[model samples]
Target: MTSLVKVLNENTIYNSEKLSNFIKYLEEKYIIKDEVIFFNQLVNFSQNNSIPLHGWFKYREGYSHTLVREMITRFTIDTKKEFIVDPFCGAGTTLVEAAVNNLDSMGVDVNPMSVAVTNAKTNSYSKADIEEVKLLIEEIPSIDLDQTEIIDYEDIQQYFSEDNFRALLAIKEFVNNISKPSVKELFFSGFLSIIEDSSDRKRDGNGLKKSLSKVTSVIDFYCDKMKLLMADISESSFCNIGKGYFGSATQLDKYVHEFSEEINKKPGLIVFSPPYANSFDYFESYKMELRMGDFIPRLGVKGLSDLRRLAIRSFVSAAKDPIEVDEIIDLMAIEIEEAIPLKETYTGKKDSRTRKVPQMIRGYFHDMGKVLEKCGKVLESGHKCCIVVDQSSYLGKIVPTDLFLAYLGEQVGFNVKEIIICRKAKTSGQQLQKYPYLAESLRESIVVLEKK
Candidate 1:
C-alpha cells in the first residue's frame, strides 16, 4: 500500500485506498490518541449558554470556555509568557477565557462582526455604561425611527416580518445615537446577537434558510438580550483584558507586535481555529447580521465580495482570486487537484462547485502556511499553539486537515507534540451516499505544537 507521505512526495494521484492507508500510517506515525471523553462538551457551544458573558451571544461556530481553560491549564504550567492570542477570534471565546483567568490577550479576525463581538465581550464595562444600557431599554418603547435614511437592504428585509423588520430598524437607529463608545458596543452586540432569532430564517450550514423559528416581537427579544448582557456585565470582572482587532491571521506578527510593545510580552500560547477546507463561507452565514450592523458597508458597495477575498481561502467561492502564497505544498495540492473529477466525469448531475475544490485546497494550505509561519514568529519559545480543525472529504477523497497543518507547523519552526483526535466526524449526507469509505476515516482534531 502506498503511504500518504510517499504519495504526497511523489505528487501522485490519491485513490480511496491510498488515502485510507495514509490516514492509518499517520495515526501510527504520530502516536494518535483518542481523548473523546476528555473533550466531551468542552468543544461545543451549547455549554456556553449558561456561562455568564459567554451566553450573551449565541455563536454556533465557537468552542466553549472550558476548552480554552483546558488549553491554558495544560500549556501555562511553567511558561514565563503571560499572554494568549487567538488569530481567528470567533465570538471571542478564547479572549474571554484568557481574561477570566486574569491574563492579558489579543485577538484578530477578518470579519468586523467578529471583532465587534470580541470587543463587546472582552472590553471593560463601567458602572456608567451599565446605567446607560438601562436607560436605553426604558426608552425602547417610545423610540421610533424615520425610515427614510436607513438603506433598504432587501436581503435582510426578507428574513423578518414587516413589524419585526421595523423593530430591528428602530433598535439600529437607537444604538447609533448612543454617546458612550463602550455602551454603544454593548448595545450593538446585543442587537446583533438577536438578528438570527428575530429573522424567519436561521443560519444553517453555509447560509441562512427559512426555518420554523419565530420571535413574538423583535423589540422584546432585544430587551431580553440586553438584560442578559447587563447581568453578565454586572457580575463579570472583565477589565479591558483582551484587545480584538479587525484584521487577518496571516498578519499575526503585526497584531502581536503592536500589543507586545504596549505590554512587553509575547503570546504565551496561540489558540485558534482557521476556516476549515470545507466550502463554508462565514460571510454568507452571517450576511444578515453583517448588513444590519453596517460592518460590510465600510468596505463600499462590493462589501461582501471584498470581505470574502480578505478571508482565508478555505471555501470554493473564494477560489476565483489569484492564488498567491509564500510556500506551496505542491505534492498534496497535486493529489487533491487530481482527485476532483473533471466536469466530464459527472454522469447525471454536475456540481460546478466541485471543479474549484483543487484551487481552494491549494489556497487554503498556502494561506494556512503563512499563518503558521507568523504564528511561529509571534509565539514565545517553547510555548504551545493549539488549533481546532476538522478534516474534510470531497467525493471519496479525504482531506486530512489536521495532519497537513501539523506538517505546515513543522516547516515553520514548531515541533508537533501530539494530535488529539477529538471525535470521528461523518461526511455530508450527500457525500456519504457516494463515498461511504470516508465515513470512518475523517475526524476533528486538536493539533498541539510548541515553538522551537
Candidate 2:
C-alpha cells in the first residue's frame, strides 16, 4: 500500500474542477469564517497514554481522554443536566474520563472486544478485587506450550521465543478459568495489554505494522500491568459507574430502551471518533490480542475480514455499492469519481487506488449517514455530537471528511455548530507529490453539531 501511494504521486497536483467545486461548496455552506477553531494536540491519543485507567488497553484508533474531558467541560454539562453518551466508544475513553469527573456515562460499540475492554476500564474494582486476581494468577499451574492444544497465531510464533509464548499462554489459560466475570475481565484486560510486547507489531497511524521486537518478561509484565490497573481503580472518583454495552452505535435506541425511563430524563452529550474513510482494520491491528486471547473462536484471517465487513464502511474491506443519495454523500462521490480521471490525463495511467478509493468514500459516507440518523433519534434536541475525524488523502485526492460530515449532520436535523481544527498534519513524502494542487497538510477536524 505504501508503494502504491508512492506510484500515484505525480509531484504535481492535477487541477480538477470537481475537487475545487466540492471544497468551494464546503467553505460556503458549512465552514463559517470565524468558526474554524484550532486545537493541535487535543485531537490525538498521546495524552491518554499517561492517563490512569484509560491507558490500560492500547486501542490504536482512540483519541485522547483529555479531548473528551475538554469537550465535556466546553459544553459545561454536569451529569445533573445530562448523561454523557459515546456510541462509537472505542475502549471507553470518553466514558472513563466522565467517570473520573463524577459524571454519568453510557457507551456502546460494535466490537465485542472493544466493549469488553471498555467494561473492564469503566467498572468499579477494589483492593480486594486486585488481590483476588493476584491469587488466581498465583494459582496458575506451569504449562508446556509444546503440549497445550491451544495454538498461537501461525506466524506469531516467530515474534516470541518459545519460552515467552509459553508463559503468555499459561497466563491466558489461568485468566480464562477465573469464575468472577468483572474480575476476570479486568485481569484479562491486563493480560491483553501486554500482548504487543510478545509481537513485533506496533501501532502506526490507525494500523499496526511489524516493528522492532522488545525483550519482555511475560508473567512479570502482566503482574505489573494488573497492579497499575488495580491502582487506577483504587484511585477513581467514580460518580456514576458508567455502563458499556457490546452492540453497534447505530442501535442506540435499542440499547438505551431498557433504561429509557432513566435515560430520557437527561439529554445526551456524545463524543466519539468513528472509523475513518481510510481502510485500517482494527481487527488486523490487534491480531495479537484477538487471536492469542481467543476473543473470537478461531477468527483467523478470513474471520477478521468478515468482522471488518460488519464495521462502519470506513475501510475498503467494508465497502458495498453506494446507496443512492442526493445530499453531501452523493456530491462527494461525484467529486471523487470526476477527480480521478484528471489524474489519468496528466499521470499517464491512474493507479488502482484512485479507482477503488471513491467507492470507499461513498460507502463510508453512507455508513456515517446511518450512524448520524440513529444518533438523532436518541439524542436530546439541544445536545451536541462531538466528533474527531482526520482528512484522508486517497489516490492523490484529499477527502474533506470533517466538512462533508458536518453538512451531512445538518441533513439529519443537526445544526452545524463548530469546526475545531485540531492540527494541520504535515505532508507525508507520498502526499507531497499531490501538493501544489492538494492542501499541504491534512487536517484533524473536531466537528461539533447540535441536534435541532
Candidate 3:
C-alpha cells in the first residue's frame, strides 16, 4: 500500500482526490446542511454580553445561553425528562440556562476556576446570601493591608500595580473570613472574575501579554461585579437546581449516574462546546485566575504538567503521543503528519509547534471518543447530544472535525441526525497567507446525534 506521503510526491492529484472523496462521503452520509440562520449568532460567547449571570465573566470559548435553551426546547418536546448535562461546561452557560428554566442540571470540567465560576452562577442565592456579599463589598474599603496575609505567587506580582495588588490581597483576606460556604464560593468567584481586568496584562492568543492600559482599580471592578451579581440574583425567578463538579469530562459517566440516582431523572439533553483542537491551552489562558484563587495547589512546571495531563489532549503541550484510531481518522492524521514537514522544508525552518499537529489530532479524537461513549450511556434513550465544534486547517489541508466526531459517535451507539453548518471559520492568518484556498475548507458546525 502506498503511503500518503509517497502518493503526494508521485501524484498530487491522487492525494487531493482521496481527501475530497472522503469529505464528500461523510457529508452525504451524515445529512449535513447549512443552517446558519439558526446558529450563526448562537455559536459563540458574544451573545452572552448582556445576559445577566453569563455576562459576569467572559469566556471566549463558550457557546451562548440562547443556544442551550433552544436545544432543550427542541429536543425534549415529546419527553417528560427535565434534566440537562454539560460534560465540558466551561463557564456553565447550559447549566445556568437550565436553572433559569427550573430544570435540574449537572456540569463537569477539569479546570477548577471553571467549576468555581459555574458553581457561583448556578447556585441558588437567598436574600440573606445576597446581603452577605453586599456587606462584604461594603467592608472592602475599610480593610487594612498590614493585617492581610498575602502569599505572592510566582510571576503574579508583575501584572499589577503595587497598590492594586495590596488592595486585591485585602479583598481576598476579607472574602476568606466569610464562614458560610456558599457565600464564600460566590465572592471568591467574584474576586477571580476581576483579576484579568485589574492586571496590566490581558489574555491574548495562547497566553498573556501586556495590555495598552496599565493599573486598573481592583476594588472598583470588584464592587461593580458584585453589584451586578446581586441584582441578577434578586431578580432570579426560580431556584437553582444546577451543580458543577471539578473533574474530567472523560469520567462523566460516573457523575451522570450518581446525578441520575439522586434526582431520579436521567438527563434529557446534553449540550456543550468542547475545547477546540487548535493548540490553544485553557490553563495558559487562565494562569492568573488559577494562581491567585488558589485553585491549583501545585507550584511549578510539574504542577502545570499534572493539570494538562488531566485535561483532554487538544493542544501540543497537552498531547503526549499518538494513539490508534479507525481507518478513516487514521488517514486524516497521516495526511496532517505528511503535510506539516513539507511545510517546514519549503520555509527552511523547523517549527516545533507545526510539527506536533498530528499528535494533537490523534489524542484529541481519542479523548473525545471516550466522552461521546459516556454521553450515549448516561443520556435518556432517544434524546439528542449537540456538540458545537469548528474545523481546523494546517497548511491548507482541512481537518474535518465535525465529520470525524460524527463517525466516532456512530461507533459508540449514536445515530447521526444532522450536521448544521453554523458559519465559515477563519483559518489562522499565517495559514491563510500560505494557502489561500483554505478559506473554503474551514467552518464551524453543530453535530447533532441521537442515542440509538
Candidate 4:
C-alpha cells in the first residue's frame, strides 16, 4: 500500500506528475471508473428525477449531486470505510446519501437555514409523521388574501398571485403550531425550496435567481414558496427520517463530545459542497429565504449592510483562528489581481463587489479550515472524507482550490490521498469570452482525504 505521507505530498501542485501517476495507479487497483461516464450517469439520474439534491436547493452556483456521489464512492473505495464527515455540509446531500447507504454520518454548516434543510432531509421518521403534518396543514384556517396584503413585504412579493401567497402562509402557520422539531424541519425544508420560484426574481428555467425586482413582496413570495415546499417534501423520502440540528461546524466537536459512548460509536459520514473561492455571496443570495423564514430581521435600506456584518461575524466565529482570516484575504487578493486583466478583456464593466472577493475568499477558507480541524478531532481514525470542489479563476488567475485545500487538510492532520479531475457542466450565464480558458471545459475536481 502507498504510505499516507507519500499520498499527502502527491496532492501538491508542484507534484502534478506524481499525482497523475498515483491517480492512475489507484484507478487500476480500485477499479475506479471513467469521469465522463460517471458524470453522464448523474446527469441522467437528475433528469429522470427532475429534483436532484442540486436541483432541490436551487443554488445555481452550488455543486452537483453527481460530483458529490463520485467523491463518496472514491473515498469509500480508498479507505474501505463506511463512515464520513462533511464539516461544511449544505442542504444535506451528503447526509441523505449516507442515510440511504446506511452509513453513520455527520454534517455541519454555519448557516442555520442549511442545517435545517439538511437535518430535515436526513433524519429517519415514520409515515405517520407525514400524515399527521398533512392533516395539521389541512386543519389550519384558510388565509384571507385580501386581509394579508403579502405583497407589502419588500423582498419577494411579485412572483405569486394573492391566493397562492395566502395558501403558503396558512401552511407556515400550521407548521408553526406543531411542536415536533422533526416535523417542523421537514416542513421547513419544503418551504425554503420554493422561495426563489415564488419570488419576483427572474429565474432561469432551473429555478435560480437571474434578477430581483424592486416591487417584489417578501411575504407573498415566501407564502407561495411554502406551498411548493410542502408539495416537494411530500414527494421525498426525507419525510421518514430523523431531525437534524441548527449549529456551526466549529461547534461540532463540543456537540459530539457530549454524546454517550454508545452513540459516539455509530460513526457518521459528511458530504457537503461548501462555498467556492470565488466571490459568490451565499448569505446575500439566500438572504430572502432567511428573511421570509424569520431567521433574520428584514433587509431594509440597512438590510444588506447589516446582513453582511452578520455573515462576516458568523463565518469568523466558525473559523479556527484569527490568522485564517488573513490567509483568506491574501487568497482573495490574488484572485482580484487576476480579475483586473480580465476586466479589460471582457466588454462589460466589472462589478465593484469583485474587488471584495479577497475578503470573502479569506473568510470562507478560514472558516473551512477550522471546520475541518474540528472534524478531524470528532471523526474516528481510518474514516474517509470526500470534498467536491472546483478550481476557480478570478481575472485570469486560477485558484487551485483542490490543491490548496489538500494542503490545508494535511496541516490539520488528515492525509490527502487523491485529487480527481472530473469534467462537469459549467455555471449558468458563464460567458466563454469572460472565461476563455473554461470554454472547452467544465472541470470539477474531487479531493479525497482520509482521517488518520
The prediction achieving the highest TM-score against the true structure is: 3
Error of model 2, residue 396, in angstroms? 4.0
Q: lDDT (0-100) at residue 130 of candidate 1?
A: 80
Give the poorly placed runs of model 1, Cα more than 4 Å off.
Answer: 1-13, 16-26, 41-46, 77-81, 145-155, 298-301, 321-329, 342-346
Backbone clashes for every candidate come to: 0, 0, 0, 25
Residue 277, candidate 3: how far off, in angstroms? Answer: 1.2
Instruction: State the lDDT of candidate 4 residue by residue for 1-452, as single tens digits.
Output: 23223433443322234434443444343322226555666656663125533345664544555566666665563223334555566676666665555555566565667777777666555678767666655544353435444544555544445545555555555557678877777667767776665555654432235554442554444444445545655555542222244556667676555432424443344455556665555566676677667777665646545444433232222223334443433644454645555665675675655555555556666666876787678767766566677656555344456666666677787887776655543544554465454434334566666788
- TM-scores of the candidates are 0.89, 0.86, 0.92, 0.71
lDDT of 1 by residue, 95-183 (tens): 99888888889999988897898899888877887888788888876666456244667656677787777888889888989988988
**After aligning candidate 3 to the native by TM-score, how far in Å is the CA of 164 from where it should be?**
1.7
Model 2: per-residue Cα lDDT at residue 439: 52
Clashing pairs in 2: none
Candidate 4 has its poorest 10 consecutive residues by lDDT at: 312-321
Give the least accurate 10-residue stretch of model 2, judged by summed lDDT. Answer: 1-10
Task: Give Cα distance to truth, residue 68, candidate 4, Å.
Answer: 3.9
- After superposition, which runs of candidate 3 have C-alpha atoms over 4 Å from their true positions? 1-19, 41-46, 77-80, 212-216
Model 1, residue 358: distance off in Å is 0.8
